[model samples]
Target: MSNGQGMATEGEVQEGLTVEEIAFIHGHLHDNVGELILKAGKFKGLDVKKLAAQIQSRQKALKKLPEWSTNEKLIFPPALSVEQCSSEATAHYKASIVSGDRLIDITGGMGIDCYYMSRSFTDTHYFEQQPEVASTAAYNFTQLGATRIHVHAGESLHALHDGLNADWLYADPARRDANKEKVVRLADCTPDVAGNAALLLNAAPHILIKTSPLLDIDLASKELQKLKEVHVIGYEQECKELLFVLDREMPEQDFKIKVRMIDAAGQPIHELDFDREEERSAVVSYAKPLGYLYEPHAAVLKAGAFKTLCTRFNVQKLAMHSQLYTSEEYVNDFPGRSFRIVAVCKPDIREISQHIPGDKANITARNFPAKPEELRKKWKLKDGGDHYLFATTLADQSKVVIVCVKPI
Candidate 1:
């Protein structure tokens, strides 16, 4: 139905799931959806397709949103939303960073961030363009006893245009275009956060934007002149989200970049804060293969801390371009994977075999021409073993395979 503003709202979400449907969903929560669909005819008077979708979404949520997934009464949205929604680990991280009297999430897709963030604020407003999804989130919030969050079904920009203001403004713009293709640039995303930076700052002094990990932090900072902090967040060694915090009052020229690595339990593993000037001005020493090798975590690498690693960890860089680090004395507290060097030699298969003396070894290519698989095939090495081989270029611009083993 048309909302009379040239925008068509989807039909109101189902008032509620039927008792039988709920029962079916709970009973088959752990069942394989494909298998259940195969035997759909066995269940009478049940919407097998609908229940199957619910089960699928809930199954995904069990790991991503463990807190809410355990409550059988809470309904789930479509599989895409469940997959795209922020994991409990990241949501908790967002909530811990900012708090205020009033908070507004303009691009509230499934309300995962909004719900978690609401706990830190007195009042939270969630706006979503999709009517059905918004209503579903509202129902879920009620079921989860999140009374502090208020859901509004409409375009987020329209909500802001209508004089809605808050102490903190948050947005996780949709990365998909009208054709359902993924986009990386902030301007291409829905809500056009880059274009409306001024408007958003007018609505709220502070704004937090969650963007795709592929986005360049430097480019984004340049786009949003009021950028305050760039948080490069990693979950379980994978870069999950790039959060940019903007403040109207803070000067844009002196923004800081932070890299945080969190475990699956939403606990911090390692965190480092540095500025571009520090990274650029830091002195880094280069050395050949050393006793220990350290590889920075994904988040650290994504934040472009190539030379900063040396200054921060007191390690030597393998090469100017190679991200691998080395130290004569083992640095047990390194932020990324650590390895003890076993042997360093040419990338020749004969030399590798002489050093490894095994058929299988973990292969990693850093600043090397060949990929892991190509090198693996050429060197006749299998995928897994206690041995870890880093085929990288040394400081002298010579290719070498540095055989390493995990410290026991």
Candidate 2:
């Protein structure tokens, strides 16, 4: 249950990386990491462990942080930090909204967000409790050509508790409790955001907190006072982070939640802003599978925008409980996958066998009794093909299987 303190051990890293180590890492940048690991015994001068970390992390950065990944001199943390830290896409999204004279990021793990967020501010503070992580961020910030960030090593809340007002206060607190357990609630996290929001507001009027995507938005809004907006961010259709913005002067009546869907390049594909009333009164019409099936993107689904999806796209809900949608006319700009109805039938073993001619076909389920694996076993369908099967509940609460072709 440990949340894992993903930092490098003492002696594993130095104050400054050596020239030879940097050269060794860059020389093997394009080489296969697995083959290099197999031949590590042959390299007598290079520290294979550090080289492996550089290679592994660089491979991830190439895709995760394309702009920063090319810098050969940047110091990368252990695998845990590399995997857990915010991707360049999410960091850029944070940068787009924040603008001010000064800003501070308290839980600066790999400093990815700090580096990007500094773009919108004149001065920035990067704080981390771990000295090694702080030091690494300091060095990489310079190597990556960042000019504004001031790296501060220590507990962030204590460092800024002196009542210095900044334009923006940002934090992505460690989502683990003292017992090393993974914490889902904001109060259970280190720095206890729920308890310290008042204390933090004393330093800045506006605060942005990043939390787990699994956190319930409705519950968070109730627990966090002065909460202004909840942003559900997604990259390549996969939901990544839940960003909460709180303002000191904004009243609850003026509060609004915004959901943004972004692609891999941090471009917004779709966005919606709604009040609590809109969510409560939003009505969705349900019908059976029509000419086409529209599946909302992951971010919209996480934001619980079922009614909004139907209203925006001019689609009908397949069932009240089912999140799937359908429309008679093709909606070209639908956020998620769109499928043309090839056929529809009850999910009988013999019917499904007849619907899908091939043994291999992609399968999915929505508001259905059985899992994908179970359906595959029952129908003896393999896992690929031009065809796709969706097992969903109709508006009448009847179990039905949908056979669909590629997007219209």
Candidate 3:
């Protein structure tokens, strides 16, 4: 499998790290990179910089790509590649979406997604424009015993132009540009997925496009006329990826959105699925602070399921725009954090102290006039305690501080 560049391809590139380099990386895996750089001269004839980078990347992988991180035989890519690559959880989730005889990854950066997704297909084609990156990924696939993935070191569009077809096509376009500035628009991304939608649909029945979390799902869905589904994924309370699945035969304006939040241990804590029409037609009740307060996870919020959440969980919103929910009875299966309302008081320190005498609580401001930091200063409250103070507006348009405690 020559990469067709005349330069060294996967079959002919340097065969991963040298034994000495591997040993050095494994030995200093827990050491600080800066210290290792300072000791570079003492360790002669070693690519100290590269070794340090591998160590850092491995450290990060311990959490993001645990299975890969433990395999010493696999050569890690540069830090940026590791950072940009999808986590093991996300990659596996993607693999579960579609499966067939043939698959193609048009923007295979580190080949993480391709390697995992290839399990569901008989064969997978990985195309990367960067020769060196593609070569390293090819070597890694070999080390991981992924014999079904074929590496193509060139422009992805060129590969498609060459008449490569598949049952499924995948792409995670580079979100950052040549200048390293982050871009959120599909057109700004490398390979211009939006512009090449037709070519992709012609190449495969299904096309899965992964974009930055900052992407506007509704806008992107409208942009990609064949969009069939959108997935908003969150990890560690932060939105991470926006996945759009396109089908050649799918009808327009009929896409559904799936929002999921994964905890630190890579376990999904909450998941909600709804379409735009469902959201628009859903009705939610409103009320003052009740016995329990619920805050939906980042993914659900990003997916804009405010009304759906209310109807689904039988809860009431504090206000139309508050995005905070309340229920007289606790909903154990609610998708977000739950707290028992201790007291609802006026936004005065004296009234707040009457309930929260300790003056220590985790403060969150939702649809409030002041920021959390500013409120913290004005109320003379220390951060971090079992108590949580929510300063938000009620249905009657009155601001109040709701003190809450985690339900035992």
Model 3, clash count?
0
Evaluate all candidate structures by whole-model CA lDDT and list the values in order.
Answer: 0.85, 0.80, 0.85
Cα misplacement distance, residue 224 of candidate 3 (Å) = 0.6
Residue 221 accuracy (lDDT) in model 2: 79
Looking at model 3, residue 343 earns an lDDT score of 95
Candidate 2 positional error at 391, Å: 0.6
Write model 1 residue lDDT over 1-408, tens digit each, in one string: 122111112355436678888888988888999999999999988879888998999998888888888877677888878988899899889888989999999987878888888989998888877777777777778777788787778776776787889999999987555575545578777678989988899899999999888887887777786888999999976899999999999954689998989876556789889999999999999999889999899999999988888998899999988999999998887889999999998988887887776699999999999999999888778899899999999889999999999976
lDDT of 3 by residue, 1-408 (tens): 355221236455556688888899899999999999999999989989988989988987888998899888677887777887899888877887879999999987887788889999998888887777888787788778888888888787876777889999998987546676656578777777888988888899899999888777877776786888898988876788889999999865589899877754445777788998889999888988889999888788889898999889999999999999999998998887899999999999898887775878899999999999999999888998788899999989999999999987
For model 2, residues 161-202, the per-residue Cα lDDT tens digits are 765568999988776644555446787676677788888888
The lDDT of model 1 is 0.85
